[model samples]
Target: MEKKSIQNTLLMGFIEDIKLRYKTGNIVEKFIFINIGVFIASLLFKVIFGLYKTNGDFIFNWFALEHNFSTLITKPWSIISYGFLHAGFIHILFNMIALYYIGNLFIQYFTQKQLVQFYVLGTFFGGLLFMLSNSYFPLFEGTRPHLVGASAGISAIFIGLTTYMPNYQLQIRFIGFVKLWHLAAIWIGLDVIGLVGSNAGGHFSHLGGALFGFLYVNQAANTKLNIWDKLSGIFTSRKKPLHTVYKSSKKTAPKSKNTDLTQQQIDGILDKISKSGYDSLTKSEKEFLFKQGKK
Candidate 1:
């Protein structure tokens, strides 16, 4: 009975550790969860309302500006909120997948705060472009369309990360290794090509998001806070000192003992290295493993 109890306790502990790791894994995971949650909610709503259209009409009809052009003048928030609501499962899935790859690369170097800023700003600009294109373009003059999906935000992250690390490379299944900039070029090229065909609104929004992403990286490198940072500061208190140090009379103790990675964490890292190459390890992992090797 005692042995069984010990085994059960160990299993429970392992499960709890996994839960924590997943919860705090990385920015990519968080973005995926948010997108999935929103997709599910939209799906439920659509089912309840019996709205099953897919030609981007439903998005414009309900959440976006329909024939009632007067309503848009009063409710401008629709432009932003519309992006979160998707047309179907496949739509959300593809955008979320793109977001995961792009966002992971972004948060690898940037702080979570910066990641959120880029995403929101990109989405705003993307929506703005969509609105402007619809309003001004002679072809789309009569049609007021609605834009949806995380594509704009995802595109921004992609562009931002590629700009920051232009030479970064990834291994493709068919192509062994390819530079990040080339990949970004291909992505943008597709959007440009798509512009000449159907889904012009989505393509135009992609351009807007891409522009914001490019400008953001350049501005950030020069030490200028982008609009998102300034906007966030409005709600947060500014009186607090930017940096603080805590002091105690007792000798400051080394944190190494308490900070050592657990056996499970070490195993997980090793497993990842086995599946992917050692290069797959992020900077933090490489440092941790290097320290462990020395010890």
Candidate 2:
């Protein structure tokens, strides 16, 4: 009975820790957790069904996007689901690394909500554009291609950052600092070339995302393109999670100016962690978070 009781206590503590992490984590961490969680679950399912020896394509089909019009009709969720699906470890690693750097740099100028909106929209449009092209193009007339991975979303983020700050220089390995627009050009060019070799749908989706990223940043600057705010407002009226985010700050005790933690500051740190990971935290920042936990 004591051992069982101890097990229960430990499990409860672990669950609370997980909840706290998710509650405090910024948009990037949440997305990574969801994607990695889904990937792990997919592998577990395959192993359980003894399909590990096979290609395991069937295991991921339920979530992977289908280029075929008829097959996609019943699995519409794949539009977004496919972004979270990855065929191999290397695929996910590169995509996540790109998202981390791009998203972090993006949040330096834009809000976290804007970053998420770009990612979501980029992935959706990428898939949509691919489907539209495939439906009309003669080159892919007889093939049914499956779209998967976060590359489109990552591509959108990468291009969006480049579009927003075209002259920003990045220090490339074995090369001196170069302008973002130059990098964007090279990346898109490679994808265009890859389309002719193989994985045409993936490459097409990437171009779609890149195009959207370029247009979205340019268009918003010219007008009141507050799409993320409008979508958030829709959820704000619901009897759900939105209300919790803005709950009374009165609950927390007041502090001196030296220790004061504003919402914006907290959000910035969270965003940094999301883009750069926990180890990026300084000693003082870690101490502040520890203090918050105690509270």
Candidate 3:
């Protein structure tokens, strides 16, 4: 009996470890969990409601029309929540597969915070565009359109990763290594085609998210203010002081020949450069000036 108890405990521990791995692996795993959990919940809802259709309107039916509308207006959380809700098993399966692959690529280089920022921002903007298109466009007029799935967010991730690492290469099973930009071009081209054709709203949403992703990576290359970092700073600012304290002692120690120069000293060197050409300095001084400029 003791042996059996030990075996059971070990089994429980293994299961817990597996759970933690999936929970904490990356943004991809979290996305998969959301999709799978929603799918299971959707199945349960179907069982209870006796509804056979997987139409987007099911959100309205299962939840309520008012609740759905409220989600659009008062609570914008639905932008993300609706991504998890799917019309069928295949709908989520493809999305999760794409997300897993693209999300893995993103997380390899970017922080988890960046992944969250891109995903949430992409989903929000995508939903906004979809709603706008459905509301105003003649193609979708007179019909209450409901969208569910992670394609828009996934598309954003794919576009963002490609933009950040345009020269990066990937190898497919049958195809040889292909440049990342090539893949991004093809994906965006398909969305553009879809924008003017059928499923216009869905395609438009994908474009909105994709555009954000592209702009995000481009701006990130030049600045430190990624959407996620800005969002975090807002919340973190509540408890933090307006300015950080840098403790400096008043007493000055003797400077050694190898000691690093102060900013003022560096500025003086630059000022001398502005007056006299590079040839005016000694070899060691020239080397020191070059090193400072590099910094």
Candidate 4:
């Protein structure tokens, strides 16, 4: 009975923890959780199937993006599914790190829906490029393996931000300060050179994602409208903020129902956050910012 009670308590605590993160955490956190969750699920399936003496390659076959167009007809979901699938630790580690840094930067200037669109569409285009190239390109006529990993999605994000803010600079260890455009150039250059290497499909997919990023930035600049927003309402569920009503005293009614900070004040705080990042905020400021978000 005691063990059962302890287990129940732990489960409840875990549930609450997830709820809290969902309430307060940003899109980047959610994306990371999803990717990690999928990776862990894959590991568990591998272990379980191993114990049962069954092959677990079915999971990869179903989820990971394949090169052949004929195979994709049966598993169309692989276009986006492959973005969340990673074959190994190093593959996921580098991808997740790039996603974290680039995603955080992306949120400063764009909405969550835009970020989701970039990731989803990036993977789709990457998969499409891989399939077309494998089918048509004389270079990869004989060999075309399955594609898996978050590299294409991560590439889209990093290149998107770099294109949007080309002049931006970041301080790197042993490298001093480097411009965003320079970093992007290096990344694309490496991928271009890597096309002749073992993972040519992967490199091509990365280029496909980078192409989307560059084009997105150019189109957004010219149109002053987010291409992703056109289809956002169709795919995304919107959560409206709740309004709290309060009773006024008989003696004097409040000038404004909201006792919270003004729009100007909030804008100032946001600017500060954008310029210095969230770590620069004081304890009280952080609390206020959090409360404002909840409101």
Full-model lDDT for every candidate: 0.67, 0.73, 0.66, 0.75
lDDT per residue as tens, model 1, 97-212: 78777776665555666777777778778878877777667767566556777788888888877776576678899888787789999989999898766688888888888988
Name the Cα RMSD for model 4: 9.2
Scanning candidate 1 in windows of ten residues, the lowest lDDT window is: 240-249
TM-score of each: 0.65, 0.69, 0.66, 0.74
Candidate 3 Cα misplacement greater than 4 A, ranges: 1-18, 51-71, 221-225, 228-295
- In the range 155-224, model 2's lDDT, one tens digit per residue, is 8888977765576676679997787789899999999998776788899999988887766664442223
Ranking according to lDDT, highest score first: 4, 2, 1, 3
lDDT of 4 by residue, 1-295 (tens): 9999999999999989987886788888888888888998998889898899998766787899888988888999998899898998898888888888888877766677678878887887788888887887788877858899888887887787776557666779998768778889999999999888889999989988888776665445322235555433322344221111111112244545344334445656655654455566788877776666665
Residue-by-residue lDDT tens digits, candidate 3, 1-295: 9999999999999989868988777667977886787788777766766655545344534432111345566655677776667777787788888888889877655566677777878876777788777766677756666667787788778888776557666767799778778988998899888876767777877887888787666545223335755543432323321110111122266766544455456545544533342345678776765565454
- Per candidate, the number of residue pairs that clash is 0, 0, 0, 0
Clashing residue pairs found in predicted model 3: none
Off by over 4 Å in 1: 1-25, 51-73, 221-295
Candidate 3, backbone clash total: 0
- Best by the TM-score measure: 4
When summed lDDT is taken over every stretch of 10 residues in candidate 4, the lowest stretch is 240-249
